[model samples]
Target: MKLGEGVEAAIHCAATLASVAGNSTMPGAALAESFGLSPSYLLKHLNQLTAARILESVPGPAGGYRLARAAERITLLDIVLAIEGREPAFRCGEIRRNGPVKLDASAYIKPCGVNAAMLWAESAYRAVLAETRLSDIVAEYAAEGDPRAFAASCAFVERHQRPQKSNPTKQTPARS
Candidate 1:
């Protein structure tokens, strides 16, 4: 049930992008550099976000990245799926059938409380994630500071970044 780091990184990167001013875009390298991460590894997460339609990349000189949509429309689950994928976290292996004493269909059917409980738990987990939009989290963060001010800081990052150089030799770091 453990999610990958890309899931958290994608969400943070997307949320940061959402805070920037409309005309500006932040490069993936800069985002990585801000956290001392390798650019190659970060690109994988960025590409996931792009595939999810959460970001649109601008190439060439003066080019970078920006959100494809408004912050309010995006959700934490969207970023999670973009990076970690939408696969169910808990895959029921149906181990109940693997035992030496396999029960008959009549004995194994519906009234099994385990399957029902697992279904209920899975639904509840999904429901909470569905309701938790990035905007809601941003709102909470903003309340701690000032939304406009935090956005302005993100704008500063966008404005101050240098163009990333293309590096053919760069490779994604192996996860430890």
Candidate 2:
């Protein structure tokens, strides 16, 4: 099954956001730059992720995107579905009924074997994705990925993450 390029971008962006500290966020432009993707192209997938509640968008100057929940709660399936939609990759057209052999509808009481097999494969594929959380991906990368690349990614996020400003009034107790 061929997934769209947007899926890759969304996954990478989510993994990157996992590195942001506290309520900090990374702009879509910076994310696009990090992966060498077009800003507009990546923005489309980012918006989809936001709409699906996989990621949250913060508006304004110090605003951008962050995960809506903990990375552990966001699965690869969530990101895939957010970008690719819920449709199965393999669609069965039922061509068996169209052939000149002219098998009656009653003759095809059982489901198409090819379709069944394809559906089974797709189910297994989705199951694996569902089992893989964004946090798992991030942890694996940090532990097993190239040290230089990981360090560079850390530096990039450090440079671009926008930490939300604290409200002093909220932090300080009122004195009557």
Residue-wise C-alpha lDDT for candidate 1, range 112-160, written one tens digit per residue: 4776787788678768877888777767776787778777755667565
Off by over 4 Å in 1: 145-158, 161-176
Q: lDDT per residue, candidate 2, 1-176, as tens digits?
A: 89999999999999999898877789999999999999999999999999999888989998999887888888999999999999999999999889668877999999999999999999999999999999999999999999999999999999999997865563321110
What is the TM-score of each predicted model, taking all chains together?
Answer: 0.78, 0.93
Clashing pairs in 2: none
Best by lDDT: 2
**Highest TM-score against the true fold, candidate:** 2
Task: After the best TM-score superposition of candidate 2, give how far the Cα of residue 82 lies from its true spot, in angstroms.
Answer: 0.5
* Full-model lDDT, candidate 2: 0.91
